[model samples]
Target: MKAYIVSLAAGVAVGLLYNVIDVKSPAPPIVALIGLLGMVAGEHAIPFARMVLAHVTS
Candidate 1:
């Protein structure tokens, strides 16, 4: 719950800033969010795969 609130607050703050600047969003928000999710998953997956392989080989 706390994490969700923080994320929502940060997003709203960024949106407010962009509104103040009068600049359009550079990319689609959903696309960018998906990319971030991919990044997080990939970052953790590589280490997890290595651990699994190491255990199997040993």
Candidate 2:
């Protein structure tokens, strides 16, 4: 569907932005995947943060 494609693009865009804005290091593929998942779920930016939290707490 068109919406799916849009969400996918948005996810990649988010990942790219993260890579640009984050001073620590380059964004990983997993980070992009999480962003994509967030897009699909209609969760905006919170899911990406949750993913990072999960990684850090693990």
lDDT by residue for model 2 over 1-58, one digit each (tens)? 9998999899788778777987443545877979887777786467888999999999
Q: lDDT at 20 for candidate 1? A: 100
- Predicted structure with the largest lDDT when compared to the true one: 1
Record all residue pairs in model 1 with backbone atoms less than 3 Å apart, i.e. clashing: none
Which RMSD values do the candidates have, in order?
5.5, 14.0
Worst 10 residues of 2 by lDDT: 22-31
Off by over 4 Å in 1: 1-28
Candidate 1 structure quality by residue, lDDT tens digits, 1-58:
9999999899888888999999787757898889999999999998999999999999
Give lDDT for model 1. 0.91
